[model samples]
Target: MRGIQLSFNKTQKLRLDKALEQLEYFSSKLNSNAIVTVSDTIPVNHEDGVLKGHGTMELEGEVVATLCGVVERVNKLVYVRPFRARYKPEIGDIIVGRVIEVAPKRWRLEINFSQDAVLMLSSMNLPDGIQRRRTAVDELNMRTIFEEYDVICAEVRGFQHDGCLHLQARSQKYGKLERGQLLTISPYLVKRQKQHFHHIDQYGIDLILGCNGFIWVGEHVEVKDDMIEDQTNKSEQQNNKLSGLASHQNQEHNYTPLELRQYICRAANAVRVLSTLGFMITVDKIMDAVEMSTSKNLNIHEMLGAEFYVLVAEREAERRSSSSKKR
Candidate 1:
């Protein structure tokens, strides 16, 4: 399912092949001939009046797939869901993106979509956490909020009239992400859910699963309204010539502890390994992989080893087989 460009030893290769073969065997038994690729004509009843949905196109009165995916039918509607595709934004979906450009009043983000998404200055909460009209001065200082290459977390606010995507960060939880690692994975692997932000208090890490396949693994930061209060207080003190009393406190925590950084790396590597194996990336799945490595007493780097890869594959095969039996 995934094409990894790493070399494997003889035993590791055999084990990996066996695990993959088992997974394929189970998949074949379940889906049979239902799966189809692009240009494939999906068989349907003409008398029933089938409605061709996404990933399908009419080709000479035939329902041909425009994408490489499995055919799905719902009453009179039929569509194909592509296996490997770019992230398609949906309203209310939380996503992680990087600012590529600071425009006139918005920041353009690269969210693994066909077109970059726009995060308007007005849509997000200001640094002071105050709600007011965005003045011309605020627009001029937009870069101070989000400069180029700043990783941001926001919610999809639907498309504009011109088909451009718009993002919003109205809440405290949605804004600039810091002290973490950003990972890219296939959007298909990330299943949509009501909750995307997960704070693992035990490990002291926060995991944000962006619907756009951009994952943020980092240290937890509390959402506070005090930033704007400090700004307000500092200005008043400056006007009264009491600047010493309004000294700016170093509130930003920059250094990540060595242990916490190691845990982040382990979790990130676990995600990478699962994605490389084409496994569904859920919180439990990722945590299980991390725990597996810990139980085996493997170092953080060893999680990416050939032997570990085969082991993970074998575990996935067993998991799938067990799930199939349960079904």
Candidate 2:
């Protein structure tokens, strides 16, 4: 939906017009003062020398917007946040990335940041959840852990003095993500929330809303500490060793169920449509979108059609207008 041109027919054109009109109407009724387009002058009392932030420029003794976005004022500082913006990594932010390189003591990952972030071997706990000094043996088996192009989830552990961003995955929740799809959206659309990891019990899907805009829609897996798991499975492992049944397991055990895969796609499509609509992406909104699709009996690809887009827009418009009235 991004960059690719979509040609709409006459009916679609009319539907989009109606939906957009409602969106604008509700949006204006809520708040319209802080919105500005490119080159629009931002009115500010320059008496105390106000500090202008990103997306603003000084021109002819006036503060002008350099981009189309919403203006945010905090005390004396003001900045505009564009609808489509690059991911800006911050310390402690959860991020999903793809491994690009496996260096001697670290793995370089493309995290949608200004540059690739480094995930040092020492920074992450071993699969056994044991803490010890990493050795040359560990370095040799780095690929056994994560190889190039593998998707991983981690947290920003601050940047080094050299300005390189570093990441860490010390918890059971953060690690390699698999059995799902990864969708990229505008970072500005994703708001940092207290709980980013979500398990949709209804669909058996795990949704990781990474702060870096790399969204993960995958099959849900139970979160458990490896330390506790290994201790509990010690007896099971011994029994399997004696029975010699480990190598005789079914090869199809790794295959994901068809229904679960469809749920993952549904969730991923919800994220895509929200990003295209420039709506604030949230877990609740995503769930609602998926539910709407299900209620309408729409196919996976139909969610991206013009009819669904209009429906989504109308729903969002109504929701916003009602919230505004409440305020």
Candidate 3:
């Protein structure tokens, strides 16, 4: 949250400090820090037969935390949730990753986890809208589907026998992401929810909240089965028709309206501001911040200014305070 470097004037710094202090007070009162760091032994009722969970190890008959995070207890089960660590993928988690290698029958992705995730050619829906076993030709033409360095969205398909993660993009909503700004934030800030894909129709933007902390803000693309046709069209293009088709293609896809681009940037900057404040990122919170900036007539570029940050902090403090009261 405060991991990002920011500049603030004397007054702005004071305002930020006060707002943060208020936030701290509210959070401290609500959550009494059932937290521990590495090597800290968690006090448990041994007579109840404590069972150690992930992030805990029995050291000298004491349950010691192996990570730095909040401690959670459920009856006889005890575990810690790491505050700052690599993303741990769970079954059905939506993730965003970059393709690192296109190997035989599978593509390796860097998913911000300990090991690279595997996207088997068969695990994903092909452009032809057909479901079948992936053939040898599919292996050879894997680049046509996903090239190296392409950013993709998928769900956790579980781990391989050797411990590498596996992913699946079996639906239209999951695939190569394009014409979007990819944002990186701490994984802890993104809480799991019933929905991760958000379409802000007001701005024509689609926001994907990856459990692994990769966020995409981009113009929404209609889900269609035209990917194969698009690929075929690309391969068939020759220098003879390049000049004429280039202009058409550029006019169709390359040009994003200035207004839409501004909106995208504005939304992206709102996310940055929230992340910088160390707040939990949710679609509602992001949209609220964006709406606030819009109501103030703040330009997209100005949203990242120090004054806006202080304003956002104050807003967050007030919001949290009210929320705590409601609870």
- Measured by lDDT, the strongest candidate is 1
Poorest lDDT segment (10 consecutive residues) of candidate 3 = 232-241
Q: Estimate each model's TM-score.
A: 0.86, 0.85, 0.85
Report clash pairs, candidate 3.
none
lDDT of 2 by residue, 12-126 (tens): 7787677778778877655588889999999999997799999999999999999998898988998898867798887889999999999989999998878999999998976
Question: Can you write out model 3's per-residue Cα lDDT over 13-129, one digit (the tens) per residue?
Answer: 999899999998987777666768899989888899998999999989899999888898898999998776667789999999999999889999988777789999989987655
Worst 10 residues of 2 by lDDT: 243-252
Which ranges of candidate 2 are over 4 A from the true structure?
1-4, 38-50, 57-64, 225-252
Best candidate, TM-score: 1
Ranking by TM-score: 1, 2, 3
Backbone clash tally for model 1? 1
Total backbone collisions, model 3 = 0
lDDT of 2 at 200: 95
lDDT score of residue 91 within candidate 2? 82
lDDT of 2: 0.86
